[model samples]
Target: MAKYIDLQTFTDARGNLTVVEKILPFDIKRVFYIYGVDETERGHHRHKKTVQAAIALNGSCRIMNHAGEGLPLEEFTLDKPSKCLIIDPEDFHWMDNFTKDCILMVFASEYYDKDDYIFEPYKQI
Candidate 1:
């Protein structure tokens, strides 16, 4: 599995903003956005070489992830203004139970390629 780098955010009396100057470990090569309603669960897939950082820019969303040989599945709920979840290769991830106007921002090391994606259904835990 790949490593995680959590970006830092600072807040003051002015406002809060995410800083992305020269702290990223990898060069950002691609960006994607997912926004809308999720009546059912979605994104049960794996990326062979894509390392991604997901941020909830608007509303909240739930993320389910499975990584490593015997690593147990984990779930995360993101709703803060600057909180984010980093996902690495070999991890199966999905988004579920999102709000009506939830906005998900993803930063990737590579562009989108169909050959790099692996879709799978939710299995027994």
Candidate 2:
């Protein structure tokens, strides 16, 4: 099942830290982030093999995801920097309702590949 993770955060007089390691599952490969996205619906697709952890580094955004196969669609409001939503390969996800200053950081298990995209119809990309 898809779920949210409260990543470990270290705090001190200096500031704070959110750590992610390979111990979670997949190794870090591709890292990206979205900011000032004008598209109301940023994604309407799923990865064929890549897994991801999306963190709301600043502001907030609402994400809707589906596991397909008669499963209920899930909604998540990512508003915390120390929190993340683990997205599995077959889950279709979309982004909407982003605050003006929202910065979404995403860590991927693999590099970007067009063939790995499964946009709809549950078909392969």
Candidate 3:
């Protein structure tokens, strides 16, 4: 099952800290960022082996998920630095319509591999 984990962010006069680390729940093997995104939608893809923790470091956006079967499509809003949406490998996920200046960060359980992704609106094999 997909679960939402609210990360811990410490704020002070210096700055705010929202750290992503490897722990029991997630062993962070890779990290990536998605930027230069317009107000339009993008990233309608799903991974076959990678599990990810998606965070909104700046601005806001939404994440939609649909499991392999006729699972109900669920939507989650990313607004705060302390919130994250954890996705399992079997779930189809996408990030859409980000705010103009949004910076999306992802913590993954595996390194980048071209074969790991399946672009969305695609036939399920």
Candidate 1 on 1-125: residue-level lDDT in tens?
33334557877999877766575556789988888865887788888888887877889898888875467788888776477677886788889888987898888878889899977633535
lDDT of 1 at 2: 31
Clashing pairs in 2: none
Query: Model 1, 31: alpha-carbon shift in Å?
Result: 0.8
lDDT (CA) per prediction = 0.76, 0.86, 0.78
Over 4 Å off in model 1, which ranges? 1-6, 121-125
Task: Report clash pairs, candidate 3.
Answer: none
Instruction: Tell how far residue 19 is off in model 3, in angstroms.
Output: 3.3
- Cand. 1 Cα-lDDT: 0.76
Model 3: residue 28 alpha-carbon error in angstroms: 1.7
Q: What is the lDDT of candidate 3?
A: 0.78
Best candidate, lDDT-wise? 2
